[model samples]
Target: MELLNQFYANEKVKQTLVNFITDGRLPHAVLLEGEPGVGKNHFARLIAASSLCSGEKKPCGQCRNCRLVLQDTHPDVMLLSPDGADKPYSVHALRELILSCYVLPNDGDQKFYILRNVHEMSEQAQNTLLKIIEEPPPHVFFILTCQNHARILPTILSRVVTLTLWPCPVEICAQALKERNPDTDEEECLRLAKQSGGNIGRALSVLQDEHLSRIVKNAQEAAQLICDGKEFELLCLLNGYNRQKDDFLLFLGELRQIFVEALRQKYGASDKNFLPGAMLNRISALQTMRILDIIDKVSGEAAQNVSISLSGAHLCSALQQTLRG
Candidate 1:
């Protein structure tokens, strides 16, 4: 596939890879770790394309090599992602890759193997390929991608150069969305970009969430109702959200954003900035800080998934108190 235009944020990484390839000293094994959809796969493919391209500019993007890679038919290029990254890679798959590593490349310049979502490899699978990784064939190169670097085995981690990828800035993401879907409003796409928390995959995911629309709607209503001291209505909405335990924390996060935006407006931040308009000037700054503190606490606990039993009610009450103050 053509590298997504959204990958512009990763130009440094692409250049780094390009430099290494041009110098002919690129490591045999590499680990690409990042938030999902920040273009780990694209970076890997670009590097793979650069390695395979026989053109003067390497990845001239118009060569026979580039065309074959885009078609997923590069003779010396191999992709060995987990059967499903949401699941585990099998011992059989790892063994196959290991065996394939020993074979000479078909055209014989270099071999590129991409193992996407290496974190999903089972212990046995990781162990199966350790020997091959330890003594890789001279021309063989591996690119492993993962969302959670911690899930990968230390042995594997130690063996590869770990490349970290982060989400692109909102303006960049918005620019990209505008390029692909010209009809989409830039401001609206920026909102989605912020909600994505630095993951393009997540930004796209946010676009598809009916639940998010409801969550945003409910949070907006709760903010207005809380400001009006509509305790009963607020409690009803919170209680309804509390049932969908998995979504509660994210819901709280949205509430926190709205409240924080209101506070920013109180401090004279403008609408062009992301702060909510100054209608909430009555709420004190300290109250906003306290609600934010509670959000941080709840968000931390929620991330560990250990605090699921903790009621969002307490956080809601703190936000209510913040509004009331």
Candidate 2:
């Protein structure tokens, strides 16, 4: 429980995990699934620490095992992630990981393989992983994290214990932000909490990184333009990113999130204050869906190393046509 104390919200998940760990019934293969900023990585680490901690209270935070895991220096904990800009795990690398599963733990009775973003793995790479996870060595455990479970193979899903994480309430997230950053004003913290839809990691990034803040601002502005059906203005605004492909991609991601929030609001989900109520009211659910589709297309083109200027033009025209139609 102490290990998970820092992880806010999700009381049920915390208690469920606590019971499993206390009863020594923790699954050998665990899958943590959630949105990008929902703390899947944090939860994964907590589980790892709890399993390997030497002290009586699992993950006492003072024991050598716990400290090592916190510092990412634990010999028994291997953190794996996809490689390259496209973020695909190499089938060859995964095969090597499978081969290493049989090796005994170096520092403890058990070893943990923490694989981040397994959803990004190609089907071939996942199949390679399935070979080991299906019948992993008794001394080895696999902890996988992903933003989407739909991308994972059914066989993999059937083999792991899946836990889904969601954002905390806006007030709870704001209070957390205030506690972590005492120097920041309460109003600013609340604003960030609302803008990020209670996602602490997302709000914290905007607070700490000026570039990300700018990207977020640009994205919100773009969403407003889309709602207002301002094709020319939207084009002019997006044209500013012609030379900054990375920033443009980030903007697209933020824009997609805004539209998703708007769509949810249209369907009676509680507003996280991602946008002004007036703006949200202006866009219908169908229009939001169309915009999301267009954004996905543009994002795909951007990922393929397409010219940012060209993508921006296409996005503007497509959105305008969809909105008018």
Per-candidate local distance difference test: 0.72, 0.88
* Alpha-carbon RMSD of each model: 5.8, 2.3
Measured with C-alpha atoms, the lDDT of residue 276 in candidate 1 is 39
After the best TM-score superposition of candidate 1, give how far the Cα of residue 250 lies from its true spot, in angstroms. Answer: 7.5
Per-residue lDDT tens digits of candidate 1, residues 1-325?
Answer: 2343326576667667767878978889888998666878877877788777777776767788777776778888877666655333677756776887888989856899888887777778888777788889898998889988898888988898888887776677666666766787888788866555335665665666778767866767776776666766776787775446568776777777677666655676523344333446545777667767877876776676644545555656766676665
Could you tell me the TM-score of candidate 1?
A: 0.69
Residue 52, candidate 1: alpha-carbon lDDT: 77
lDDT of 2 by residue, 233-307 (tens): 999999899878888899999999888878877787865766788898877788889989999999999988899
lDDT of 1: 0.72
Write down the TM-score of every candidate.
0.69, 0.93
Q: How much is 116 displaced in model 1, in angstroms?
A: 1.7
